[model samples]
Target: TGKAYELDFNQIALDPVTGEEQGRRMWGEVSLSRENLMPFLYKLHYSMHIPEGFGIELGILLFGIVAIVWTLDCFIALWLSFPAWRGWRKSFAFRWKQGGYKLNFDLHRSGGVWIWGLLLILAVTSVSMNLNVQVTRPLVELFSPLTPSPFASRTPVSLDEQKFPGISRDEAVSLAAAEATRLGLEKPAGGVFYSPEFDVYGVGFYTAENDHGDGGLGNPWLYLDGQNGALAGTQIPGTGSAGDIFMQAQFPLHSGRILGMPGRILVSLLGLAVAMLSLTGIVIWAKKRRSRVLSDQRRRHAEPEMQAVS
Candidate 1:
């Protein structure tokens, strides 16, 4: 249903030997465009892809910078919109008798105050997700040892160098379940992927930490030997460092998966609020520009009359 997948070259391909672009087998179909819509929004919303050819990383970098700037502006807007002690209550409520301009201004100002925290969270999480390696990851890792160093010796066995035939898929999964149980994980489920380059089985599992929804976040993972089903190493979410926890929480917080249905509704409302604020801002700007032009015209007409009187 909600799974996002790419073409499985190993299964269905035009030229398996050459590995050229080919058709794919659709494993399942959704009732709507849910599968395609998410990726399209993700790519466009975060500036991950424009023309869809090249420079995706560069596009993300540029958008990451813009997000940072926008977040800063949001902070400034929050500071500026803060109501004084005398007007604090008034700031929370809109006055209908104050006319259109005041209504628009109050709605714009108060609605912002209402959603600033959500906006800030969205902005921070967006930056972290987009600039993971450069900014967020490093900042997170500064306090935690979740991510392994690049120079660390994995010494993983390659799939081709197997001494004996590899274990069956079911056996590998059994080992993962056993490992999960040994670690006291609740409701553990795992899957293994055969990586040719490393010659290892990458097994990832969901645990209690991921009890909320799909468990994409806060999942423990490990590498297993494809041949003998030996447990190479494991990363447990329960004992993960602060950085690991923060990074894991990012997706859930961004997508409102942590809070479930109500959380999703709130996020959707926040999007509408942002759009409303943007439109009101444009209207305000246009009205100000019109007023300025009319004032200038009046001043020019009065200037000649003043000159004649002088």
Candidate 2:
């Protein structure tokens, strides 16, 4: 049928209008397609394509640990960049006149010094993204209050035990729209999503064009209970405790979407700079290792000669 329908994890598609089976598509068949490239890359960034097992996402945990290490490394790098107060300006200057290894060293140290703040922001936000419940949320809550997360509040059921919602997606969207209006929100209902595990429906407030939430603190979302359509929680960005606002700003700040197209462009360039710094850092390390090895070899040869002379 050409009519609208909702697909479940079991590969069953049901028409909300008729409450009848429409058709079913294999889950992998639909997901593993060319159109899903962006979504695949997005997941890869945070999860590294690791499969979930034993109720733990190993990929996410691994990257979260990496982010924590990277955050600490940023501060250490900054300190190492400035060796003395007498010539602190050297940390920010590039040795453009002397190219090759000197330039590479300068790029690694000076380039890092120039954009150290941005790099730190990215590292910290990566941790927040991967370890929100485990680390970020708890840390944020220590200083400021946070409304309970709807996803965390509910225990997720197994796929076989998934429950279908009593109200339709349309009804949930309407309820959310009404709530948005009552709360003086200006945006229209953009989309609706159902969580089979948690049995909750979330209606996002935004336009189709702004679905990615390019500007500001991103869009607001209303979550409702599946069984009775009761309001479960609301995430109206820019309106919450200090910690709540900080948490809301994480993705926008990390992706540089807070500044819209210009922000995205800057972030793209920043990524290139980071790659360059890593390459230069490796080159510097290799050259030093080679010199150290040669010095050790010479020292060993001289030690035998000195013993014989003595």
Candidate 3:
């Protein structure tokens, strides 16, 4: 960061003749280009050893999940409504006698039983979406650049002072991203702060949420080991592309977490279903218990008098 100044994209940034801004936008433009994208991705995934079309397949899988999640939603709704259907099995469930409405009775009670397990499975699996990916994926791709957040064995990481003597904001950001790739850091994201007075480069990495801070489950950042080409002691969680601070941030934006925004709204609806189902299930179970106890008491009272007389 530097003193705020207005910049013209067309003149200062895009124009070939503009010397200062040309290099700046060059990184920005290619930040997502086919030429440099894969390595930039490698820096994040930490590897690139997958089958030829694995990345494209992964994209397909991500798309496939949308349909899967939607299907899960329909099942969840069916499951939650099961208790109301089960009420039909009761003598006066649904405010009428199941004895008289046999077809209606089966519709409520049996239909719900069929979908209940399926709904529960979907809910649990959906929550595991990110967790499963996080816990297992990066390690699997430790040697594959296609994976997110894989670290390299010989990455330059150091804890020395005076390493980044003349490094500025841009240099610091580049070094952090480069080291992250070399060292196999996963899904790195952060901002760059520059100061001529400090004459040192500080590149902070974290989640897009801006929650990644020093030792706070925050994004890991590194102060350039100015003396040597290594990262200093700062490990924020998550990684993004290398090249430019502001530009690489876009991919992270697409990840639905720059704002700590929820991944998808599917889970939100699922949560509502869970709450409703839980409450209705408890009520139905309670009602069934009371009915069974009453019936037993009535039977015992009816048979006792005759036995005593005999």
By lDDT, who's the top model here? 2
Sort by TM-score, best first.
2, 1, 3
What's model 1's TM-score? 0.70
At residue 61, what lDDT does model 2 achieve?
A: 96
**Candidate 2 segments whose C-alpha is farther than 4 A from its true place:** 1-33
Local distance difference test, per candidate? 0.69, 0.90, 0.46
Better of 1 and 2 by TM-score: 2
State the local distance difference test value for candidate 1. Answer: 0.69
Residue lDDT tens for model 1, 88-132? 766567767986988888778877888888998888888887787
Candidate order by decreasing lDDT? 2, 1, 3
Per-prediction TM-score to the true structure, in the order listed:
0.70, 0.90, 0.32
lDDT (tens digit, per residue) of candidate 3 on 38-129: 54464333122232264344433443354356456656655555546556444223424444334343334443444455455453343334
279 in model 2: Cα distance from truth in Å? 0.3
Error of 2 at 212 (Å): 1.3
Q: Per-residue lDDT for 1-310 in model 2, tens only? A: 4333545544566887997987654433225565455656777778777877897999899999999999999999988999997999998898899999999999999999999999999999999999999999999988999999899999998766788789999899999999899999899999789998999999999988998799999999999999889999999989989999999999999999999999999999999999999999999999999999999999999999999999
* Clash tally, candidates in order: 2, 0, 32
